[model samples]
Target: MEENDVLVTVEGLSKKFCKDLKTSLWYGIKDLISNIQGNKNERLLRPKEFWAVKDISFELRRGECLGLIGHNGAGKSTLLKILNGLLMPDAGKVTIKGRVGALIELGAGFNPILSGRENIYNNGAVLGFTKQEINSKLEDIIDFAEIREFIDMPVQNYSSGMKVRLGFAVAAQMEPDVLIIDEVLAVGDLGFIMKCFKTIDNLLDNTAIIYVSHNMPTVSRLCDKIILMEKGQSLFQGNQVGKAIDMYYGSFVENESNIVFTNGSIELLTIDLLSSLKMNDNIHEIKWKDDLLLYFKFKLNLYIDIPIFRVLLYDKEQRPLAIFEPNYDENLLKNNNGFLEFTIKHEGIQLSKGIYSINVTAFKRNSNEPILRINNVLSFQIIHDEDHFQPFLLSSTFSTK
Candidate 1:
């Protein structure tokens, strides 16, 4: 796009926030005093102050869609509010051309006691729409919102989904030159989401859009470019949506907690879950398709003639994801009087890049009854890899010494 076609330009944008309320009030009072005294010095943060948004820059041209993605409190909302002129930046400049339609927060400009129809007028006036213009689009807005039945009803009685639908419909139908949307669409019903996407698809020809959503799939589908934010800074920005998503999901793998149960029929001794770039070298993490290992020790309470071993895998929601039977057919446990050892080695562990529960269980030969079941006794994660095998061996001796 040409320079003249650039609709939004942000340069060195920064915003600061106090971490404590008392300190913030004090700073405000002190700053007010300083202003009265004409101090005219540089503004600096005092104790317990922090930057909510550091230096960040980006641009959007006509007919372009830019996506802002990050975890909560990553300064995306602050940036959007600044772009829409609702808030001022502490430093740097934001130049946005043409009329802007912002559906920032769900029911942000709306009154609870006001009817939906009345809210439509109030919001339109707030967004700089004339009475005749709002009247022209009134039927289309109501039709698009699918809230005709609730048009005269007070919005305080509306459900969250209903509010989202009405708010989106008004913001979309007003025909602004630039559209800025936060994560409010996440609360919309599926049908309304489809309708809104269709409307947005139609608007892309003439409007510039800034979208912020944690829904990666949708962002990948809609945005021409994506910017990743971390700790209030612009960490990455590019056109490779898949690569960006990989980094996004990979950042979350190491922070999961492991849950183990020792009171079951089988008592787990120790579990070893590691990933590496090569064999026998233990690294805390590795890229996709790196060497992996899963090893553990457990004891059998009672003596069994022949026992079969199994491992059950589950997701964070406690739903079963996959199961592995390692020493089921082979008679690897000739001596079952003491502790048993298990080892699973693979060139690259295959998983969808998330934490999963690794459960170990056992059963007697020629019987459906499980001799032991260890539920969620082990867990592991795949940063980005997938494929392996099953390996489990029974140990012969048991002694703490």
Candidate 2:
């Protein structure tokens, strides 16, 4: 694509956040005291200059969808804010050619006290639509939101999902030149999400999409290119969406130590996949009968009590499918040097083919509560196969809908 085809250009963009600058009880108290004393000096110490996005630069071509992937604190949201003019960068230039509409945070622009119908008009106004324009689009927005009965009700009365639906309807109907979305797809049911995706796909021709999500497979499917962020810097930018995802997760797990088990307690230190294992890996691998071992190393911290290590699997919808916590004898684990291992046998793993997360919990002998617990330890996938599975083999065919 020619350089002139670029619709969004970001150069040396950076953002900073400060722990001290956060709004806390102490900060609120300090601000109150400062106001009382008329002390302007304390305001100087409020803190800025902590870059959340550091020297990040990239160009997004027209009609191209760019995915942003990163860990929680990474500058994904910060960069999105800058691109949408919600937040200005500390030291960089961002140039955009078209009218931008965003679905960043759910209900970000809605007034709680206002009726849903009123909020739509308010948001439409902010997007440069006049009253007549909003009036013309009101019926369309209401139809898309599927909130006909409650449109006149106060927004505070709406559920979170309803709020998202209304907010998305307003933005989507605006027909902006660019769209920025951040994980709002995570809300609502699967059917609703699919409808929204279909709507956006139909509008993709004239719009450059900037999407931020932790769901790597979805990103790979929808985005033409991907950008990986870690800490405050862009780690990778490439068309090979898979490579960017691998680098992003690889960077994520680097600092964490693998699990170690000792005594009678097993501690799952690190849960990572083989080089072949990726976020985009098939969902069949996550099934009950998959050959791939969930390689986990646990440590028995103390031998005073028996330990039971459990692996729980949940589907993409976060519904618990199966649980395995084979209890081993105290004598079975003699060494406490952190080299104990456990495997979830493939005999009875029953899950439909889709993405799943593994949650780990360790319980002590006869104790109702777990001594060590970690939620969402790892995630894996299962793939579709033409052959109907043998009894012990994982099933291939499953539908996302």
Q: Which candidate is the best by lDDT?
A: 1
Residue 285, model 1: lDDT of 44
Return the lDDT, model 2, position 33: 83
lDDT string for model 1 (138-222, tens) is 9988998888999999999999898888877777765777899787778877888898889888988788989899877677677
TM-score of 2: 0.62
**Alpha carbon lDDT of each predicted model:** 0.72, 0.70
TM-scores of the candidates in the order shown = 0.71, 0.62
Worst 10 residues of 2 by lDDT: 384-393
Candidate 2 wrongly placed segments (more than 4 Å):
1-4, 17-19, 22-48, 106-109, 251-401
Model 1 weakest lDDT span, ten residues long = 386-395
Query: Residue 13 deviation, candidate 1, in Å?
Result: 1.5
Residue pairs that clash (backbone atoms under 3 angstroms), model 1: 350-386, 350-387
Q: Per-residue lDDT tens digits of candidate 2, residues 1-401?
A: 34337889999887666666455456568657866986534122245335688888888877889999988988898899899898756567899987888877655568999999899988887667899999999999999889999999999999988988887787777676778988887888787788889988886777888999987667867888888888889888878776676565544332222233323355555465442234543222433444556666765665545456677775543457677646566565434454666455554354444445666767665764577677667766554332111212444688898
